[model samples]
Target: MAVVQADGRLWMTFGPYWTGIRMVELDPGTGKAVEDAPVHHLATRPDEPYAVEGPEIVEHGRHSYRFASYDACCAGVNSTYKIKAGRSASVTGPYVDGDGTPMPEGGGDLLLAGHGEYVGTGGRSVFKDRGSDWLAYHYYDAEDEGTPKIGLNRLK
Candidate 1:
């Protein structure tokens, strides 16, 4: 995922699920990672051996929040995917949850999860509209024969 920070720097997070995910600075003009940019771990699934996916970064107030999908995905109602998050003061961070546990060491605040007719609530993206922040994502609708459906929530 990519985010344009308040200071106009472009940042991105990416990596293989089985290995790990990390953040890197990008040159806005060149659309490429800055040479020799330091890579910082975005997160690894809490209590699991693999890293999370679908990373999203958003800046709010004095902190930058990173969101990622954990568990599994694309299995319709059987999917175990859920969204988790962490925040940091620096864009390239040692992000931590509300309890102050570091993200790279398997710590994140539970943000969204499967509930009721919705299963696998993940693949989230955050955007601003009309001066307000909004979150958009997809979920498997169990009541609708496990069809994937879009969901949105206003970030407060």
Candidate 2:
């Protein structure tokens, strides 16, 4: 689990080591602890199973929260790697897609996958800057082709 410090609140993204992505809110006034808060589901796909790892959250201003997750469709194989994203207005949300579909039922946008220049990119962490967002993860280098290395890149 990782917590992000936003304007006046604390937002956290968490997931089962082998399952789903969820978001929670912490009370900043109470020293950054959840105040009877419930975790909100952010992403899940039926066709893929095994795990959802490395959840990171970023506030896109004051009202939007974006959650990024690495989907391990099949554990132990680079071929099954993929990354997905979801967004919500509140810390706790019924996060919907561009078409208004909920996550657990296959919502959100596809961010990246093993098929790209970087193979097996997973274990992601996201951050916000002056006006941009970045994604940090470990990827299997295409040059070495089989060795994994850590990388950080701006996410447009």
Candidate 3:
């Protein structure tokens, strides 16, 4: 999700499942879509079964960071999901991960992945709260029969 300019147009992902994510700008006054606005084609993994989703754009310092979750999810012990990140100089981007890999080309810098009892950690969202940044996501716990768990992290 992203807020474009001071007009408060909230842009979020709307999708038809594992295909791709589209960004639609919403009308702030009514929290409805501004009907005539163009639907932006944001990003997609070219790979079949394209598991990319959850796009969150954050404007920090001189860059806009684009966060996305990749790989399979929701199958308990079978999940292979993980969170990835990329940044661009502009809101609309040819976003590249740390090594300069473009997101659309299946490139993303690792943000979070399974560790210990946690497996398939993904579906992350980043935002600012009271002048500080935060990241939150879900994971499947392997230590407790694969139950889903939520994790939160405060970013500096």
Q: Pick the lDDT winner.
A: 1
Q: How close is each model in CA RMSD to the real structure? A: 1.6, 3.1, 2.7
> What's model 3's TM-score?
0.80
Model 2: how large is the Cα RMSD against the reference? 3.1
Q: Which residue pairs in model 1 clash with each other?
A: none
Give lDDT tens digits, candidate 2, residues 30-100: 64658687777766665545456666666675555455555553333354566676677765666666787
Kindly give the stretch of ten consecutive residues in candidate 1 with the minimal lDDT sum: 42-51
Q: Considering only N, C-alpha and C atoms within 3 Å, which residue pairs clash in candidate 2?
A: none
Question: What do the candidate models score in CA lDDT, each in turn?
Answer: 0.84, 0.67, 0.77
**Which candidate model has the greater TM-score, 1 or 3?**
1
Candidate 3 ranges beyond 4 A from true positions: 1-9, 30-32, 129-131
Worst 10 residues of 2 by lDDT: 70-79
| Candidate 1 lDDT, 69-116, residue by residue in tens | 888889999998888889999878778999999888888999999999
Give the higher-TM-score candidate: 2 or 3.
3
Per-model TM values vs. the true structure: 0.92, 0.75, 0.80
Ranking by lDDT: 1, 3, 2
